[model samples]
Target: MKRPNIVWISTHDINPDLGCYSGVWPGAEYAVTPHLDRLADDGARFDAAFASAPVCAPARSAIMTGCFPTAIGTMHMRTKAVPPPEVRLLPEYFRAAGYYTTNNVFTDFQVEIPPTVFDDCSPDAHWRNRPDADQPFFAAFHGMATHESQLYLGEEAFAAATAHVPAGARHDPAAAPVPPYYPDTAVFRDAIARYADLIAEMDHWVGGILAELEEDGLAEDTIVVFWSDHGRGMPRAKRWACEAGLREPLIVRWPGRIAPGTVVTDLVHTMDLAPTMLAAAGLPMPSHMHGVPLFDAEGTLAQAPNQYTYAGRDRMDEAEDTSRTVRDPRFRYIRNYHPDRSAMQHTQYPDHLATWSELRRLHSEEAKELAQGLRPDLLTPLQRSLVAASRPAEELYDLAADPHETRNLAGDPGHAADLARLRQTLQTWQGRYGDLGLRPEAEILEGWRPGGRAHTTAPPAVVRSPEGLAADCPTLGSSIAWTTDPPAEEQREPSPLERTAGIPVADGRRWHLYTGPVRADASAAWFRAFRLGFEPSPEVAVNIAQGVDDAQ
Candidate 1:
């Protein structure tokens, strides 16, 4: 059987608000995503897809590695944690299986992806750039047009954009429906409308990519999978484990394989996509991957419906908290390890939005109202609890009865048995995954630090050896690499400096990889060093002026 080419198009902070999910959201009729709607019409639409982690880096890490972020020590947001060397990433497996893998620009994965994972991984990386026309390819395109920051363009710009809104594409903020927890203020409504506009923009980009596939005549042979990194970029959505945060829109278009307009209601996690793609390519799933393949070789659903899907939240931006959630079809359970912390923790990113400011202002006013011997009905009990100094350790909600998850049933005697069952399930999952959430934040940070500070490779000290210039990092076991040109900054675009031949030292090797010292005739050289789980060292230049004996 031939392996189908795969194109994974992922977007940021979007949930299943598309027309095909149900109906166009009120006031978001202008979010006419005809292309995505058409794709859903022609392929499989997963209604219960969720992200394993709420934040970008951790969720992306889970998706790329097919393992829970916690299992790989990548659960914390933006904290660089290197997985054990033995763990292989999804693209690496696909590449090993003869697939030309490329990641178009953004790789916000929490861990460093070794160079071997991709054939090309630059801003211009694409399946169209593959050297061989017949080679099976795996490409990922990440769209950021719908990111939360785009909604922060200020009121004047938003009004101008809304006024000029393309013909029938004008979303009225006054008619937008706000979340139950949020006050129906102009700021909140405008934010929702702007978000819808961005989603429409993101859809346009998706259409262009699909058109390219058709133009290349690779549409039929390629499997197109579209999804978002997590949920909508709102206060309670992006970093929380509510359905708004964890649930995502997933559409798979595998022409001639998956029947048109098929809807799968089975629970699926984002991490599962990695293993599913591997299975589609006829490769075995590695044992290290925690995700299960959803489809068999025949392009039919092979797995039984999952009883529950899990999601987690930890250390988003400057806020530090640990929360775990378990969601079944009917019930959603949340366990907050840091119950003393308010749900409205000071996260710098979300605080930039007008809606966030409105929420804070409303909370303050509600507090004042209560002090004056009167309670304002503007805030719901759940909303009040969110801004409180402490929170319930455990919360249980029945989605069938209260879809908004406003009521907590954890303490209800009638739901005690249901709560216990879900609680046990969450605990078992935590144990199975070796959840690092239970560990103290300081301990986790200390583990990533070397010599009582954050682990950063120091530049190798260049000394005038008897032979010539010798470079070595005294920090023991640091991997050293040196070249005539400087290395690229870590996590940025690959520099032309990378094209030059360089010496590399293997991890755990005490000595530098270069066996012999540089000769006097050599030009000035640049050197750097890095260890797994740590930041790379600053570039150090060794000038071989005049002769080796006179080198500074």
Candidate 2:
């Protein structure tokens, strides 16, 4: 049997707010997501999928490697720690197995984007761009229309984000559902309505992509996967490691291999994606990956499915804090390491949102009401917890009883066993994973960058071989990317993490992932190499013209 081709569509900072998940989430019914609904109808929709982290960089890093972010020292956003030599990326294994891998442009994985992970890592990459029609390909597409910044980055950003939604199709602000964490205000309702528009735009884009696939007559030969990096980009949902933040949409369409309309309620983590895809493609899962495979030819998951999903939060943008959470199907337990710190800390990015400003305004009003000994119903019980000066050391919520996490059951003696079990689970996970977030940031940085300067990967050597030319790097675990074509005057796009990252990200469009040998007479050949988590080597030019050779 032939291995199925894989195509992953990842959306940023979104939740399962599609029309198909009907009663799962309250506001899901309001979304006009015909394309996503059709996808679920054609395949399986996971009812209990969870992200490894509440934020994008950490969660995406975990998904890419199949290892927990904490285990590999990538738990913090824009983490500067380098991975141990043995912790190889998952896509390299795919490429080794003769699969063409491509990433459609988003590579903010906290670590440097390794040079050999994908055959294509630019905005123009797609499954259709594969060289051979028969080769199995793993393609990834990214959508950022629903990102948190889009909602507040001026009216122009909002207009571009929601361009697909017609004026008549816009949702009514009054009809939007309100989460218990926020006070019922017009500002929030309006934001939610606009959020629906963003989802509509995403759905339209997906439709176009699917249409292209069908037009190519490759729909049946491919396995389609659609998922979000995390939950809704709102105050308590996006940054907090709560149920609202961790829960995300997951849909898979594998013809003949998976039954249509299968709704799975297993407690599966998003990290499982790496192992699952590798396993489905008949490849061995690496020993370092912490995720479990959720696929087999029999169309059933492994006998021992996950009973719980775990997540943590560390250094979100400007906020410095530590917290961890573990959840069974019906219960969630959160341990706030920084118990003295307020739940709402000063973060310059999210503070600009209208909803954030409005929530602060109402929180201040409630504080005044409390000082006057006047008990007012302005803030709900759960909403008050978000703006509290300090957080409880431990929190336990029976999600079945209080889905909104309105009440804390940690102090209750009746559920002692549940609390003890979850607490121990969280403890065991932390001990086993060896969370790097516990260490001081300065210490980690010093270890990665000795003398305040990064250690660069050794430049690759271009040698004339029987085949023509082969480039090899001397550094251990380093990957080399080279091109035989002459260099073009392409402008390099800058990355915010470029200067600080352990490995400088290489963003070359024409370079190919170096394998054995290439047929090149050494003329017009250019080479660049990078190790797992260190600075990329400077580009090397070989066999250039006379004037350029003198400069070299």
Candidate 3:
């Protein structure tokens, strides 16, 4: 069988509250989303699909490379480096396997704008209309219309839905399942309702794209994989290791190839998608990819005694912390690098913030007490004084017992054995991946620096002229003109990381710091990171720099 066209439809922060996942909406149960619903009815739906990281950048990195976020050092957002070149990304693999690859202008690889993931990554008709009609295609798309920045529509939709209630009606705390730690307030309900609206809108877009695929006669030849980068935009959703943050809706459809109406409850991670696609295409899986194909020709997953999935949260919003989690079918284990941080620390609790603001504005008499009681900045519902101090360093959760993960079981005596086993698994993974987890206190005490480089206090300056090999350096006062193309190397010497480093900064002003390597193409983030004196992630940087432009 020849390889089929692949269409990967990815969305931004969204939760599993759709009609398919949650029966809350009208007609959701009998919703006629012929494209997506048909896919689910025809192919397998993974109940346990999860993102490797809860945030966008790292999650995308893991999805693309079939490697954990930490494995590539792309833990944080825009600040962290991109993946080094040479390692084949999922799209690149498809491209090499004789497929025309396209991406719809969304590159969230923790770098600057203009993603560098593909050969034709433009948002124009170019990607929508692949010239290579004879070859099978791979088109990956992401939508930001439902993201936090575009949250107004959801808010408006929610207010309209609740218009029947009197403006001054008191909120019924009993109506909703109050988070053990939070006060059941109207604000919370409002937020959840608004989030649902956003999700509804997102689904509409998903349906639209799938509809277009069908209209263009691409659906039949395509294997449609729909998923989100992470969960929704709420506290404990986007930046945490909890199920709400990591678990994503995954629907895979490959007509006649995958079994119809199958639901895989086995533990699966984001990295697994890449190898699975390669296997489906009859292409040899790269040795570096850590994940396995999800199914065989018989349309069944490989049997195993236990399955493991992992997730990590490095940094998001304002708070920067490190955490890793391991989840089996039965339990979820968390290893927090900085346990002292608040469980909800960098997370933006929109409802809490808005409520705190409203109470102070409307009820001034009680405002002082409420403000005094609550940690104004912490966003926790509790008014405890001591709890605001710092977060703990480690935590464990009995996922079966507490699905919401409201209680921490790390300090419990009864769970010691379970904790130890999970810790061992974590250590084994760390060793296998050569993880550079937070350095030990002793190493820091001994004045250790990553990469063994000292912080230099010198501004960047070009010593060599734009043209290569001048006997003399440019005069200090002379102005250097910018050039479009940097000098091409007939035989470029590989950097330490086997990367090509030089790029034209301005006018033939070739600057080379250290970019890890060249991958699909170099991004602008590569230039900036290299300029910052750290090695640039060639693939990510290039993607960010060039964006989804077809020429890039």
Candidate 4:
């Protein structure tokens, strides 16, 4: 009846091209990662694991709470707010059940940790590390080095350490199944290579942690789970609901408890991890968790049930849009909530980065144009055709036939039934979670402001309008104008700026206004104005407009 010690290692922005997953990765096949591969060989490897959402905060939230991101309104990465404290968060559950809980600072939640949640907040420590030999522990370690922005050393390190790759074996653009959205070039190959290298580096980090657990003689008694917050960070990857963005590498290692070398291909989501951990700890599953425990009748681990895993995408990176996907073993279905918006609006690829001097040297001017065809700013004729012609509603892909999700099956007459079934599932889920599809016009800029400040203004009245003014605030005292530029359309009208002022009416109600500037002592004033439903105080307004506005 003793609870097992738990150690979970999570990496940010990793792809499923590791040595255990596939041999096609040039970097992983050549790089050294003896420890991770050994663990996989001796444990379970999940071939069908997926993240509920492809962004960091939402995905982590789902895993931590065993609830769908949509249910809690944290479907977007860092966009939506975090869950309220009343919810039974996974860590608090373990702590309540007599286990020490600790985290190595992965604070991607929308709100700061409340003082009641954890026993410690220091960088190198937490409650699990407290010198209490009698209690079991639940600990999490997050590795941010694998993040795409920080993978500067990845490419060079891969080239240096993976010299064993055959010279001609390097990825060839012509042979590769290049996604229609991206220009097939050495640049893409180099990007993937760099990504592979970062994954290998993460392998080393996981090995080090596992070795430490073993050194402490807790290896056999500990259940270790390795996963990524989401999929790879690339142009179309992070912000989309495609497999590249929504899928993740999930490996569960529980000695004696989980059968070894068992490959479970059934669909499973990140949320399941929380309930499974709780069940392993002998705690009753909370009714609030939407995920089912993946265990056998005798309380040992078992394969997950066969079902469709879901994922959603909302407002991340430079691109702002909404999308959702559902994938079973055979097929994947995607619903793009904003079909008018280009994928590039949600992401910016390195194709525009002038720092890659090799781009100029590798091709002629015409070739450069071809290479930059999918550039966010300049779409090639073919790119424009694809983007403009594609339907805004739905897409279906037979994943077995096209693992990369290249072709859309929704248009075919033969797939109508399949599409209908998936669409029904999607709609049922939306109703269950109360998804409004797109955010209301009034809420679009409700808490939004330029830079890192929250704006305060009267709650705007929203109305759909062909004039382009989607919202009108009472502060304006009348209907204002708003316009949306459609595809192949001209900017024939000015955008409506609903009237807002820094001052508020003497009434007790409060409003938020976008302050163009800020002054000293804005923090206290910000909360006060927010509470009063008035524009932020002059000090807060100045602080937000000009940033803290003074030396610390």
Candidate 5:
């Protein structure tokens, strides 16, 4: 059997809000994403796909390492966390398996990932740059097609992004549904409709990516996986530990392997993409990875009987919050460590959005009127709870009965048994993985960046030996990378793809993942070491005697 090429497409700040996911969740029916819908019809769409965290950096970190962010100390948003010493990203493993890896490229993993993990890693990187047609490839393309920034508070920005969409393709704000937490207003409805519009734009972008596969005549020989980092970029839906924040749309297209029109409802995390790729490539699953493969031996698209998926949230931007959640087939249980903080803790980042701005203004006006006795409890329970002084320590929601999670049944005696079961499950899961978020930020920060500053990894000492040139760094568990015949500078090309027809050779100057010594006799070799939460070490130049003799 021949190995198949792999193409991964990741979107930003999206959720199960496409036409293919219409029946999976509420408010999803409003999208007009024909490209993704057809892709799902041709391959498989997973209804229970989820992220390990609700934010981009943490969720992306989890997917990269095939481990939950909380377990690997990468749970906080926008903050780099040091992963375990043995952790190698999926691409590095793929490279070791003799696969030409590429990333075109978004590297917000919240951990230091060496550039050598991929042969080409830039906005223009592509599998077409590989050595030959026979060589298997792993190409990943990530972009902000439907990201939160697309909301476009400024009219000029909105017009520039949505100008491509036809009048019929645009969504109707009047028909948008309002969740219980968000007040029914024009602003909320417009935000929902705009999200659907962005989904349409994302579908167009996805079509272009898929067209590339078809254009290269590799669509039938490649496995394409599509998923988003997290959920929609809305108030209480993005950074919170709710169902909307964690659930995502996952579709896999494996020609001749997976059956068409298969809808998988079993729980699968975004982190599982790594193990599935390994299984597809006939590579051994790393013992430290926490994900379960989604494919059986016969390519039946069946999983290893997973009952629940988990997620965590911590230190979102300017606000400090911590929560862990466990979701079964039917219910969701969230345990908030800092119940003293309100669900809407005034995070400065989201406050700038149109939806968030409107929601805050309404909450403020209502609070002012209530405080002066102008209105008596006029706010709905769901709305009031979101703006409460403090959140409940525990929250339980039956997803089937309340898809929107508008009701919390934690204290209800009728649901106490299930709540207790899920709470215990979360505890056991956290303990088993040694949840690093359990420690206060102060203690954890001391280890990552002491004195609120990033440390630098020591330069690797490269020594010539009988085998080759071996490089070792004094910094514990630092990753090392090297390249020969390097490019003149580090800058992107004007085109989206920078491919050379010539085949790759031993001393091509392309970066290599430094697992051991370099046996290839090359001109000049540049080496660097990097670790998460630390500054990358300065480049160490080692000139071979055969070429330049400028060794340092």
Candidate 6:
């Protein structure tokens, strides 16, 4: 069998809101996503795809490494945590199989990519840049135009910008449907419309890449995958583990293999993409990955569909909370570790959205207005209740009956058996994964950075080898470098008379980037090591008393 090329195009902060998945919600007939719709038409669209984490970095980490964010200690947002040295990233496995792998411009991966992982990882990185035209390639292109930060523009400015939206795709703010939890004000409605507009913009970029593949005559031999990092960036979404936060739009186009217009309802996680790609490349799946391949070699759904999909959320920006969710086709169960923290806690990112601001204002004034026998514009009592209510320790929702997750079924007497089953499932998963969320935040941070300080790597140790002095770093995965001179020591003279005495120093200009053993002409040398996101190792001097050759 011939190896197929892989192109993964991932977007940010989008759910299954495209016209193909189901028309855009709340009366908007369709979102402008012709290119994405075409991709769905040309291949399979997964209606039950979900992300393991609600936020970007952690979720991307899960997708790239095929491991749960909690298991890998990357569930916290924007936290730097690398997988153990033994683990290999998705692209690294492809590179080892003689495929050219590239990640274009966006790798907000929680873990650092080892030096050998990619052929190129810059803005210009692309499959076309592969040294051999016939070589199989795996490339990831990230589109960020639809990110939630884009929606932070104030309502007036956002509305003004919508004028540039394609005339055929434009949506009116007045007619836009607001989620039940949000106040139905023009500000909130316009924000939702603007998000749809951003999705359209993301589709434009996807079209460009698809066109490139077709023009290059590689579309037939390539497997193209499109998905989002997580759900829309809004209140009760993004950082929350509800369906609106974890569910994603997943479409895979594998020409001549996957049947066109095929729709898969089997539960699939974002992490499954990596394993699926490895399977397509005919590489053995590593044992460390938590995800299973979604499709068999013959392009059919793999046997024994997953019984439950899981998602987790922890420490999103300034707001700190820990929650885990397990969902089956019909039911979704959430366990909040910190139920005391209100679901509406002031998270930095969501608080800036126009809809969030409007909701807060309405909720605070609703009581006063009702006392005066007045009603706010389109603000329902239920919506205000959502804003004021605190999260429960356990939340159970019958997704089949209430897709919005508005009703809490945990307290319902009739669903006791269902709740117990899902709770046991979540507990078993947590135990098996050694979920760090069970630990205190301070403890987790301490584990990441020993002694509660930025990890300071030890200076490279120098030893004699056949060639010369070989430098080895004590900290695994850190880059090593050697300088003839130790960093300039701070001169603190006890007395002015001692200032004239010369401090022995080697030539600083002789610094060299360390790859392996290098023949050193000098008997003594200085070495240092550093890794991204960690403190630099202190410079140390090594004395070769027996000379480099004799020491060997």
User: Considering TM-score, which of the candidate structures 1 and 4 is the better prediction for this target?
Assistant: 1
Q: How do the residues 349-439 of candidate 6 rate in per-residue lDDT, one tens digit apiece?
A: 6776677788788776776787889875446655754565566899999988788888889999999999999999999998898797667
lDDT of 2 by residue, 1-552 (tens): 687788898888878889988898667898989999999999989988899899988888888888888888888865655876666667777887888888887766767666577887777889888899999999888888888877666678678768888887778989998877778889888888888888888999888888888998878888898999888888888888888889999999888778898888888998999989888888888877899998764456564368889999888878898899999999999999999987778788788778888878888898799899988567777777787778999999998888778889999999889999999999999898788888898888788888788889988887666665677888887888777666558756655545443232344445667777766545566788877778888888776433234212
TM-score of 4: 0.70
Model 6 clash pairs? none
Q: Per-candidate RMSD vs. true structure? A: 7.6, 3.3, 10.9, 14.8, 4.7, 8.1
What is candidate 5's local distance difference test score? 0.82
lDDT of 1 by residue, 1-552 (tens): 999999999999988878778642222244668889999999999988999988788898889888888777788777667565446557766776778888876776765544446666766789988878999999999877777887888667655533424756756788676777667788888888888887777777899999999999999999999999898888778888777788888999998889999988888998899889988888888777888888866688855547789988988877889999998888999999889998778777787677778778888898788899896766677666656788889999997788667788999999999999999999999888788877886677676674567567677777777787787776553555555543444444444323211112113211123434656444766566655455677866777774334323
**Best-matching candidate per TM-score:** 2
- Quote model 3's TM-score: 0.69
Give candidate 6 regions above 4 Å deviation.
23-29, 154-165, 370-378, 452-552
Candidate 5: residue 110 lDDT (0-100): 73
Where in model 3 is the C-alpha error above 4 Å? 23-35, 80-86, 111-117, 125-128, 152-182, 296-300, 304-306, 346-387, 437-552
Ranking by TM-score: 2, 5, 6, 1, 4, 3
| Distance from true location, Cα of 507 in model 5, Å | 17
lDDT of 4 by residue, 6-35 (tens): 888888987565677664222235333456
The digit string of per-residue lDDT tens for model 3 on 482-543 reads 11233344534434221211111112233322212222233332232221123322221122
Q: What order do candidates take by lDDT, descending?
A: 5, 2, 6, 1, 4, 3
Query: For each candidate, what TM-score against the reference?
Result: 0.82, 0.91, 0.69, 0.70, 0.91, 0.82
| Residue runs of model 2 more than 4 Å from their true location after superposition | 153-160, 297-300, 370-373, 461-474, 486-509, 521-527, 538-552
